[model samples]
Target: MRIIPREEWGARHGDGRYWTTLPASEVWLHHSVTVAPDTVPPWTDDFEAIRTIERIGAQRFGSVYGFPYTFGITPAGLIFEGHHIAKTGAHTYGHNTIGRAICLVGNYETDEPTELQLDAVAWLLRHGQAQGWWREARLDGGHRDLTATACPGRHAYAAIPRINARATQPIGGGGASPSTGGAQRRYLQEESTMQLQPGKHGQYRSIPDGATRVIVGCPHGQMSARIIWHGPGYPSTHDMDTRWPDFDWVAKDAVHNTIHRLRPWRVPIPEKATGFALYWDYPPVEGHYDDYTGEVSFEF
Candidate 1:
């Protein structure tokens, strides 16, 4: 594996602080969510971008948690060392000690990552596992697998299965097997009956298995909805705000209620997901709070 060490990027070592030894059992993938400059070439290695990310990490989290992640991957598939394996990273909240974080440098929600970037991540995982750096590693997932925000977006997250497959197969050889025994596409829909009282959170309905995509719609009220997935070791939740294109406004009234409309949102299901929880939040409106009651639908 070709890697740019800390010294190569002029990064300084920590102040002799180290994380407690724990078996590295997982690899958590992340996206920087930073916009790249259009002037740069597509496959060119951007060392300056890496430095800027590290500087941002040092400024934002250095005092309390040191650097944020163990490594960063450039758009050209170049890998840069971050906090090193000796120190615990501040990447994944509950599983930091047990997982290694490798962040790809781009916002995947708006753009797709290059093939080289995907291959580099697979190569790193395979190499790390062989060296026993990830002695107990078996599963790999996105940063959102353990958090509330969308650190790794849909495009990047979709590549997780491919990356996992490449990690086990011979380099530059066979690819992942395609799904067989095609099951009929299914959709599960649910509507919210309980009102979302002001200044309170609503209970989440459990998401059934074999669900590939989920579409949630608030039929009558304006509220922020969340799709929380509960995995084996990590649980991630994402709010449906304006960031997602699918989270759009839908007009149903003929002419009476032009200003108020139902908001519909969609999100992809994470792999190895056992179940999911769906909930909504009602923020204050015009300095006053009101109860929101609506129905939600899911497409599996």
Candidate 2:
């Protein structure tokens, strides 16, 4: 694990900062509000993403002379080491924290992250886990869990589970054993601090116009798994207030009543999306499941 000076990162803003010589754990997941292409020119590769972060951090935090703890950039699966962890960074909620800040290039709305970019993130997280920087005990979360804004767009965050799944799976080496369950166990998504109405049995709600849906498979009882979603209306602005909300009431016979557990869910508000959104909600008590929902406010 080589550390680089922020000054060498290229774009000004935050420099002279330091980062960890190696990661602490295995759970590496990330997001970026604005992502540019690696081949677009301004800087060298997608690493310019980190430098751009420095510029933005400097302007927002009013610190032109300091460097944040750590910064990272991704376009596909390629991870670039930009700064030393010793210098606290101004990125992600704060410059200094337990997790390393990684940003990917591209506006998710207009562009989908390439397999390479996603693979890069998985590698980093796996690397961290191998180093004991992150672990399976901790549930990987999204940027929205910390702040009020949606810095890492839906398209980007939506892919977290897939990325995590990839990282945990063994490729060249031996794959995760059956006992470990490999990548299938770890799933992550960005949650908006805001809260919303809880699901109930036989009740009907409607998803507003535009919404993103993310689905993940959670631990299910013997021989069964389930899916959850925003059956009615958009996700409200209410926070669950706790790590896990109190399980609410719903009919066992709901459309998909078996679906429980709030996995990250995002679905675009398109005519087709509207159909997709309600598909999970039809027939009261059928599509009921506990899952996190949020509104997408970022533009492409």
Candidate 3:
């Protein structure tokens, strides 16, 4: 609930350009084009990175990037408020009129943010929802959808519906389809990262070919298992908080904190694991050598 004011949050671009703002009506989602490092440890925890984006936006375009209400998901799963919601932001051209924007750090074209980034974003969205920011808020759409430009990016824009779904679901009911009572799943798909898969001992099962899992134990130390299936009524990946409701498991020894040597592993894919949501960078994968190496197998 604590928001840093614009005066304190930004400075005139070296070009002497100032930031802009947008009136907040609904929460808009976006990807920051800052091209961040693959790993930010605890992203939101880094205050400088957040400032840098605004600085760049202001310098390049003579205005701060994104909307004032725009927030960002740090590489470490922390939510950071970029600008003031009541003020206008320079993020989008037309969409800024009725939307408060959220920009995820990192360049989607060149790199994907870590699990921490996703978690931070989801956290911010939920917070806004809890505060009734979206009760009447319409999600973000392209300038072309309303006016012009290919802003918000393709993949980032595609995630809007899912993002809205995660924000609107009923508490303790589970997933996007609350009425179905089906469990929602999230996937961790960064190049090199480890997540806890849902499975157990005596239940050797093939983790299909491509399923997403979470990191419950450690990064990658052989204490990993393929989640056979998730229980009905489990929360969606976006709704799952990193600090709260810690992912419980029957096989806890599989997740390892650190790996001896860097190697690629697929995120543990579990059978029947549908609608997998992924975090930004929880299970830190070495970007240089750990691209697309995340998974484990258990045959039942």
The prediction achieving the highest TM-score against the true structure is 1
Deviation of model 3 at 122, angstroms: 3.5
For model 3, the stretches where C-alpha displacement exceeds 4 angstroms are 1-23, 40-45, 61-69, 113-116, 136-138, 142-144, 170-300
What is the C-alpha local distance difference test score of candidate 1?
Answer: 0.56
lDDT of 3 by residue, 1-300 (tens): 133334433333331123333334555556666655334221111344566676667665655343233565544444555655455566566655556667776665445555444434454556565665544333554333554544456666665565556445443222221111112213222322222232232222223234343332222322332233332223434334443222223331333333222232334444344323222223334451232223322211
lDDT score, candidate 3, position 32: 68
| Model 2 per-residue lDDT tens digits across residues 12-117 | 5544344443343322234555556442111223344565665666666655423332445445233445334433445554424445555565566456776655
lDDT of each: 0.56, 0.40, 0.42
lDDT of 1 at 108: 89
> Candidate 1 lDDT, tens digit per residue, 2-60?
66677655454351135656448778888887655221121112445665676677677
Q: RMSD to the native, candidate 3?
A: 13.6
Clashes found in each candidate (C-alpha, N, C closer than 3 A): 1, 63, 53
Over 4 Å off, model 1: 12-17, 37-45, 63-66, 136-139, 171-300
Best candidate, lDDT: 1
Winner on lDDT (1 vs 2)? 1
| Model 3 TM-score on a 0 to 1 scale | 0.44
Name every residue pair that clashes in candidate 1. Answer: 192-295
